[model samples]
Target: MKLLEPPVSDYSTVFWDATREERLLLPYSGDRPFWYPRAVAPAHLDGDGEVDWRPAAGTGEVYAVTVVHRPGPGRAAEDGPYAVALVELAEGVRMLTNVVGCPPEDVVVGMPVRVCWHELSDGRKLPMFTPA
Candidate 1:
């Protein structure tokens, strides 16, 4: 399905850029393990946060999940439900994404998954997970 793409910004742009390369970038500096691209962490008291990029193994466990019977804009029109999951990466960060290569009903909490890429028409490769 088509998801809402955010306007380009200095911080988030770097994230989208990395995803295009089939990589996932999460801000990790001083308690910022799982922040989404926008606000990476609590603001540093006296200085900008030391943000750096680390290559994630892209392997994770399913932390939580839901079966989306109702599709949204740009969603694939299929029989019905699809799997959307909150995955906790090996790096100890959690991400919200879909579980593909398997049925939504087959996905279970604590299931293992590996990163996969979905190439968009705009040339962006978004990260999704499939059963490992």
Candidate 2:
């Protein structure tokens, strides 16, 4: 299926690049932490723009989730009653993604999940969560 989204720019480019590369990217400014990409470190209020990008452990647990029986626009092939889960990575960042590899009814809160790559029609890979 073709999922469409706008191209990322600015500090968030690193995130899109990492997703295409099938890796998890985390942003760090010195000792401070950040997510979703920003021009400066939110903790120290530093505009140094000295962010560092690094790979993160893709292992995580399903913090919470819900099954979408009715697919939304452009998500028709996602299968009825598919799970959308809030995955809490080992780094403590929680990202919402689709949980695959099993029936949606079988998924439960706090279940173990791992990052997996789903290839798009354009050859870019996106991250998804699956049973660990």
Candidate 3:
């Protein structure tokens, strides 16, 4: 089954473009990295929040995980038992992504993973994770 396309806005356009090339980019302010691409970094709210788009190492460890028994909207029931994980990237940012290439039961906290891509119907690539 096809997954829903992620919303791409002007602020996140660079991120989406990097994903298309099989690379991961994160928004940064100074040395701190953040997710959910925005014009301003969460830490530099007071001063001028200059966002820098930078490449990520694309390696991370699973911080949390869950097995989905029931598929949500736009998902197929036959694809049940998928592993959804919160991965803490090497840059110290956590992103919600699917953990594939292995059984859901095998996904556990602190498990190492690497970036992978899932192509959407609209030609956009969605980043996912698999065992590193």
Task: Using lDDT, give the best candidate's number.
Answer: 3
- Residue pairs with clashing backbones, model 2: none
Stronger candidate by lDDT (1 vs 3): 3
Clashes of each: 3, 0, 0
Candidate 3 residue lDDT tens string, 12-88: 88888888788889888887788867877786444358888899999999999999888766778876768889999
Q: Rank the candidates by lDDT, best first.
A: 3, 1, 2
lDDT accuracy of residue 41 in candidate 2? 61
Residue 129, candidate 1: how far off, in angstroms?
Answer: 0.5
Instruction: State the TM-score for model 3.
Output: 0.92
Write the residue-wise lDDT of candidate 1 on 79-99 in tens digits: 467888999999887899989
User: Which segments of candidate 3 are over 4 A away from where they belong?
Assistant: 43-47
- Model 1 TM-score is 0.81
Q: Please list the residue runs of candidate 2 whose C-alpha ends up more than 4 Å from where it truly belongs after superposition.
A: 41-50
From the highest TM-score down, the ranking of the candidates is 3, 1, 2
Using lDDT as the measure, name the better of candidate 1 and candidate 2. Answer: 1
Please write out the lDDT profile of model 2 over residues 37-56, one tens digit for every residue. Answer: 66666655464767888788
TM-score top scorer: 3
